[model samples]
Target: MKKVICFLAVLITFVAAFQLFRQKEGVENESYTINLRHNKSYHDETDELIYKGLLWSFSQVGATLPKKTTARGIEKVTDTLWRIDVSKLGFRPVVLEKWRRIIAAAKNTQEYHLYGSIMLNRFVICSIYASNHYYEMVQAPKTYSEFLHPSVNASSKAEYAVEISSVSKGERLIRMDTTVEAITAQQFIAVEGSGHFSQGNFKEELFELIDMMPNGQLRYLIYSHNGRLVNASPNSYGDAGKPAKCMWCHESYLLDNFMSTPNIKGYLNYEQFVSLNKRNNDKLIKYRKQLSTEINYENKKDHELAEIMYISYMEPSAETLAFEWHLSIEEIRRHLAKLRTHQHHEFPFLGQLYDRHEVDKLAPHKSVPIPKSIREPNDDEPNLLGAN
Candidate 1:
């Protein structure tokens, strides 16, 4: 009788353990379901699922963009799917490639939704939860001047000022750090003045001096302020006595000409500067107009129509466009067909020319003409390092 009692007790304990394990697993699976019903950013069931999937994937890969980390990896799981892996120590390229394939084979964008992740300054990670709607804003190209220039006019003076008045006897200028990993894969880049500066004095003059450096080496100038060469960041080329070290990383990233003379941060804004020059501005003007149109279309009430316009003009991947707008691939394809009816010619799947063609049909006689001498900065131009 005692033996029977012992067996029964053991069985009960085992069942309890199994039940607990099952409950934990269920909770873990549902963990991504954020109750954003009351959140303003919420879209619909599809949008919610996209957000959940993106968040879950990010969590799984431990991708957090924190300043001063070792390496980070982002993989496009699909047009509407993505995963990121961030590490303090290192990363695995094979894992990134795996996610890339997974994303590629995923369902079309209409069936899924799109999301994007951007890592900035090795520290800041910004995720566009609703990428289909807002990816253009996130991915908009900016010139070095536009990237570093202050957003507000009032802040411009103080923002770009270099400290000269309050220099301590041995005030050390901190050398800027450059990592090959940090330079590559970033969508937008810029440079800004650092350290405390006297009121109303700007660093544009200093920037001009740095801009003149050979091989477009702008990173070399961050080592000094007020004629004193400060300490360089650890493991940096500056610390290694390689002032022109930026070339190595930039060249590898296919941005060797990013800092070429014509693309440097001149006295005028990019558009303004291009206007004054004798260069052909047709490409620049068209690119800017397209960006403007995308931004305008993002807020349209008829999301389906808005998406149709976007895909027709932008010609993004069907899956990617669908993911961005919370539609399926089939839905996007159907919209493309409708757009093709309006356009006499067959639309190219991926290119910028689609925007001009679509705009001509949709808004006849209303054109944003490129200025004669205005040229848009190349998309791959070197980004300026903004003031910390």
Candidate 2:
């Protein structure tokens, strides 16, 4: 268990800067937090990464402008190419070509590739190639072990985070420690932020709260106003050491079952497949030669045509567009009102609390972009310390 201690003040990203500044303008300008832990700032917003490949991890994001990878749009990089490069992170003295292949398959895109034990520490490392694109950055995710099982059910986006506040004295920050781990080979990667914070930047006060973790017990957790909360435990991560029991399912849960659930039987791209020959011989054979092939040709074509027509031609008129415009105003207002009413009653979390306010003092809004998480983080040793 990794124990983490944190002390936090009213720390807001660039997102909240203006809201805080409007209250007291003309100051020399307040600095913001930009550490490796999960953070969100208007200046260092997320679309920048989503434009790169964020969906593999984060969900329910609402960037002011849909993140655009290129000048105009997004072109999702295909997963068919499992490209993993270990040198990107500079893993170790001992070479492991297999490890690099494992990470390449796991990078940015949300998916899992199981492998038998290869090393002692199981010190799995995830990659996020942070580059100077648009104006943004993101905390790097390590594995499917951390994905399916998260530390906390983030009210917003679940992120391993460090809440940092700019103080006159210096930089004050806090981190949420612990991540989920798999238990056995037959066991699936259970999701949980199960460890404790082993280290972090803290204030003597808010910092002491996490000192109670048992050495290796703390698991998947997420940062929240109170502190990081465990969203999952060992069982969800995999059949491992402790059978993490759930409070709600306490009647049948046990902590010792963790290590006994048995390693989950996973499939290779080959194992989970029915070779091209089995996908409807005639159809697949034909799809292989068409400009745009199809597995469920009829259904897919029907849906595609309707969807395209509706979006291309039948979409609401401008007046009915959410933004105040001239053409379909009333209809749009009615649709939005209905949407708001429906969302308020059912999807409050997905509703409009996403505020992308601007710092009027800053320059014209510019798009922020990020690079792939497959680059070498140690290409330049002099800048390595600063990179983190």
Residue 282, candidate 1: C-alpha displacement in angstroms: 40
Please provide TM-scores, in order, for all candidate models, with all chains considered together: 0.26, 0.16
By summed lDDT, which 10 consecutive residues of candidate 1 come out lowest?
119-128
lDDT of each: 0.27, 0.22
TM-score of 1: 0.26
Winner by lDDT = 1
Clashes of each: 24, 64
Write model 1 residue lDDT over 1-388, tens digit each, in one string. 9999999999999999999999985554232211111111122324333333333223212232222432223334444333333322121444333323323322122222222221110111111111111112122212233323243243222111112212212111111112112221111222224332233333321121122111111222222223322222222111221222222222212121112122223233334333422121232233323331111212222322222322332333444344334568687666665453323133333332223234234321221121111011112211121111
For model 2, the superposed segments whose C-alpha errors exceed 4 Å read 1-136, 141-378, 381-388
Candidate 2 structure quality by residue, lDDT tens digits, 1-388: 1232222223435537876777453221111100111112112324333223222111101111222311221222232111222222222222223333333333212112112111100111121112211001122122333233243433422122212211112222222222222211011121223232234322321111111111111122122223322222212223211111121121111111211111222211222122311322333324323422111223322322212211211122222122212125455444344332222232233233211111111212221111111112222111111222
